[model samples]
Target: MSRDIRIVTEAQLREVVSLDLETVDVIEAAFRALAGGGVVMPPILSMAIEEAHGEVDVKTAYVPGFDGFAIKVSPGFFDNPKIGLPSLNGLMILFSATTGLVETVFLDNGYLTDIRTAAAGAVAARHLAPSDVAVAGVIGTGLQARLQMQAAHLVRPFDRCLVWGRDPARAASCAADIAAATGAQAEVMTCPASLCEQSQLVVTTTPATEPILTAEMLHGGLHVTAMGSDQGGKNELAPQALARADLYACDRVSQCETLGELRAARAAGLMPDTPPELGEIITGMATGRTHDAQITICDLTGTGVQDTAIATHVAARLGGAGTVIPV
Candidate 1:
């Protein structure tokens, strides 16, 4: 007896999936499931290729009720743009949860990761940001920066967007792109502090080894989602900033302590005690924003459960649209 496995290309996946409210809901459910327990997720297997200025990470998870699990291989080469190549690319393999057999191969080339990551930002904003967000700011001008703004807008509509980056030209370009795509007034800010002062919601998406956002920039009635410190040695916000937040949450407490901004805070003796995970807040196990004046921060260190959720979703949406091979 043989089984069939579907091969879905990046183009096919793009046609079925996008960074929209539907995808955000899918990721939100994954976080809820994570909080509900019975989800088995393993530590990420990561490697660094110093000579090439690149790193690769492999992650997977098995949800009890899900039909399949996904193993995603993601690579990020920061220097790729110098040669006109993309900075990130990868694929995901979905396998039957019960049978442990291959089910679908998604050659998404990191597209799914991008969508789910941006969706996670939206989830953070939906649950933590102030209800009446007039301005939103993003600290980096990369793909995630643009997508994070768009995704956040889906949940918390803002009147304007502030963009900041190391490269002024790129920041200006990103602002223009956001204005064109989101129909929101977008402008480039010279500094992160200035952006934070005016925006009610701020997202840090840079891979900066040094701190770009500091405690002094934190103000009342603000929510910050720091998603760039997914790897070790990457610190976007100063440790004091985390300590200053009225509420600090993590996508996964353990992962954030090791890879996200929490790592730096812990090392600096700032956040001595463990904070609640995002799943906890989403499932009502923990409290979210209680008052509009609360300063909230969420550390999103990408999780394997999210990959499993999005991959399963894409597989279903394909609905037998890909090439089938028997094994």
Candidate 2:
């Protein structure tokens, strides 16, 4: 007896998928399913290579209703750019839920992860940010900083964008890129505090051990999505900032406590009680932003369910586009 397997390349996946409203909805539904329960997901297995400034993570999840599950291997080599390579790259393997056989191998090289991550940010903003956002800001100049801004725009539709980073030239370039891509007025800010003060929505996309967005920067009618703190020792928001927000949400409470911003908050004794997960809000199991003046924050540590959902979705869309092999 032999089995057939499909191999989908990054190019094929790129042709069929994008960071659009539909993609956002798919990721959002994954969260809803997670909140609904019956989803089997494990904690991420991460390895850090200090000498190389690189890290790799392996994640997998199985949703009850889905026909297939995905196991993803993602690697981030921060110093790759010095040699003209991308900082992030990885692939996903999709397996049949019934037989646990490999159904497809997606050579996406972290493209799907990038999309789902940005889409998750949009989901957070959609439920937490003020209904009317005049200015949106990002606190990094990386690829996620750009994708997150675009993703939020799909849901919040801001009029202006503020960009800030450690490097002035990179920040200016990021602002110009945002302006050109989204046709919105984008400006480079000197500091994160100024950006947060003026923007209704802010996203932190940097991998910094020290806090970049602090408590003093938070204000009424503000929504912050901290997506950079997915590994232990990565702290983006000041611990007290979580306590200050009217509501603070996490993609997954346990994962956040170990790897995300919640870890810092818990260590600082600011968050004693567990906060609501993003999935709870999506499924109405918990409350979201109720008033425009309330300040809300969502801590997103990438989840395995997102990878499974996105991989399943991509496999469906591939639909005979990739090469097939039998074993």
The models' CA-based lDDT, in order, is 0.95, 0.94
Worst 10 residues of 2 by lDDT: 175-184
Candidate 2 local lDDT, 30-72, one digit each (tens): 9998998999998898899989999999999999899899999
Model 1: per-residue Cα lDDT over 1-327, one tens digit each: 988989999999988999999999999999999999999999999999999999999999998788999999999898999999998998999999988899999988899999999999999999999999999999999999999999999999898999999999999999999998788999999899999999999999998999999999999999999999988889999999999999999999989999999999999988989799999999999999999999999999999999999999888889767899988
List candidate 2 segments past 4 Å from native: none
Alpha carbon lDDT of residue 159, candidate 2?
Answer: 88
